[model samples]
Target: MIFPPDLVIFDCDGVLVDSEPLTNVVIRDNLAQHGLDLSIDRIVDLFVGGTIMGVQESALEMGADLPEDWVDNIYSEIFEVLADRVEAVPGIIGVLDALDAAGVAYAVGSNGPHRKMEITLSRTGLLERLQGRIFSREDVANPKPAPDVYLKAAREAGVAPSRCVVIEDSVSGARAGKAAGMVCFGFVAETDPARLEPICDSLFADMTALPKLMGLPQ
Candidate 1:
């Protein structure tokens, strides 16, 4: 974060809100119901860094002929659960405030669909800060690990990819940021720090530390 960022891009789920654990738990349980029986740790390692399509493809590889309504079903269940469990990531408001005080622009870039973002970010009280500013996988041809979403986000923000600083919670997102030429900082509070060590320019588990990395006064 020593570099002054022209734009700051946040990946919504784990980076901006504490939804990953809840989401992952649901995923694990749902897969178990599908007769997959994978542990939560295994689920995180296998799916944390990929798109829903990738997840579905992995399911297919696992011998699951997922019903066409499978993804929608999971989404419905996740939203219902999240309504009661969702919360912003600890210390993120301070980071957002610091960025605002420094006059830095930031936006959310996620692999989630619009409705998911609407439900989660809204419930977490982040919608007003980012409503129209959010970008999703539905906006691009390819999701994370492909650089499509990150590149489009940077382009729309009118900043060079090199001048943007991306905050990511997964290896796929870190790779996408790097692929888009942005420096990515990995948030490893809930995920194994080692997973993103190779791609993230820096790794941090606390949200309050981010503004300092962005060269903002702490």
Candidate 2:
């Protein structure tokens, strides 16, 4: 609600690290193995902001013959690929630098599990900077679209929800931020604008543009 919010909370997968495309490909291939052939775009639409457990539930409902160990197995595969190839979202480091220069605090709040983030963020070289500031679904009873994760991040940051701004890349994450009573900026570089335009306080397509959007000096 104000220039230079007290805290900035970022979603991990699509917002901080560019892991969605890689993860989606893995999901699509695995789903096909189970007889549910979905496109990468469809995978993103259904699972981007949700957890792997949610994906299992949805995939089952959609006729995928997922086994009992599917979630664990898929995660192992995802973690393997992420550890080898994940990279930070372009300009994210610059954005963080600007926030640092402006003296605004930032943290990561994600629907992803800790182990997954450990692999992806580490691979992207963001884990060290985010070390203790990362809040994941494992830290809360409910994940995104429920507000628990974002609320936890703000609470732990010692900032009021009103003074926090969430950077999200999906409908579920945006909804969670709003439910947590925070202003949310949607990163639409990899997402469809129409999906987030109605939910976000603002929208940005480039990570380099985020510092200005957040009222940070260049």
Candidate 3:
């Protein structure tokens, strides 16, 4: 926790790309078709920061009775919608610009799989900006709620985890950032501040405020 971290690692779904609601809509609809109806809030509560595999496991435990091809099917559907609908989180591009201007390295670290990120990030025009700097859970042995992905991102950035600042938007993601020994800033636009406050080093609802919060020049 110092001013001007060496690296900034952002979670993808809600932090970088505004894809959570779009992704959740697909997940909710797909689950309802399988006889496991869940509200979007419930979906967020249970699956927002977890991997699709984690969703499958949890859904089965809750009696989802998903088909053998459920994971692939849902991913295909989610990717389709995201490819058409995903947008960069408001002011995120400006934040990236600020980081670039300050010469601060940044990357994406998410519980999502690489294919999912490729779809969302590419759709939102972020993939090129973050080329070769993205770390997905698929790249590691474990996902969020564990520090693997964030740690991997830090390692690849050639920065110590302690000197990295992680921007996350979910409880699991914030926990992962903290577990990785980074300064965690919970983005509260789509998540409850109460849920993140206890876990994060700080919280912000606006991407425009992030640069200042991280001690970056405006």
Candidate 4:
């Protein structure tokens, strides 16, 4: 089936940028400093595509008495490492160019904090392509799986929810896009495609297939 979406929404960490492994590494390293260490898979399962506060809350629930300032410290460490290592996902630029050439408007809707989002996009050279079109979880009362971010993104992009398509790599993000009434296409990068397939309207094995899948004048 052809999906003629007016606006294409992208998730940042695992979708647009290849930063999920880095993020999990940073989180694990920082937490280890405080005597709290988590496996990367656990981190990915629990924190990927979740808000900062939500992750902190989860950490607390997991028995870590992280102070209010812990989030700040984690951010600082993550950004310090990210500033030097973050890069765009392979094929992202090509996909973006294809979308632009097709005149399909797109925006980023992420559950990450504003600073992290800014730094990742800027350091990876994606900021210019996404300027004025980035929407963070902070922009809404709730994050992914709540649909607020995607709903707001669609509105800001001047497209109705049904006319928008969301590209995501996490279950939370895909769920949010579906809840927002948009077609959700899962981009399986580091995860198993079968795991993401059921929740996603369609699954793209790589970014190279996105334009065609979205019916973007390919």
Model 1: how large is the Cα RMSD against the reference? 1.3
Candidate with the larger lDDT of 2 and 3:
2
Alpha-carbon lDDT of model 3? 0.92
Q: Which TM-score value belongs to model 2?
A: 0.98
Local accuracy by lDDT, each model:
0.87, 0.93, 0.92, 0.85
Q: What TM-score does model 4 achieve against the real structure?
A: 0.95
Stretches off by above 4 angstroms in model 2 are: none
Instruction: Candidate 2: give the clashing pairs.
Output: none
Candidate 2 worst ten-residue window by lDDT? 120-129
Better of 3 and 4 by TM-score: 3
Predicted candidate 2 versus true structure: per-residue lDDT over 71-168, tens digit per residue: 99999999899999899999999998888889999999999989989998888888898999999999999988999999998999899999999999
- In order of appearance, the predictions have TM-scores of 0.96, 0.98, 0.98, 0.95
Model 1, total clashes: 1
- Candidate 2 vs candidate 4: the lDDT winner is 2
Backbone clashes in candidate 2 total 0
lDDT (Cα, tens digit) per residue for candidate 4, span 1-218? 34667899999998888888997998877776666788888888888877777878887887786777998888888888788898899999998999889888999999987788889899888998899999998899888889999999888877889888999999889899999998889988687788789999888777888888888776
Clashes in model 4: which pairs?
none
What are the runs in model 4 whose C-alpha is more than 4 Å off? Answer: none
Q: Is candidate 1 or candidate 2 better by lDDT?
A: 2
Worst 10 residues of 1 by lDDT: 48-57
Q: Let me know the TM-score candidate 3 reaches against the reference structure.
A: 0.98
lDDT of 3 by residue, 103-128 (tens): 99999998888898898888888899
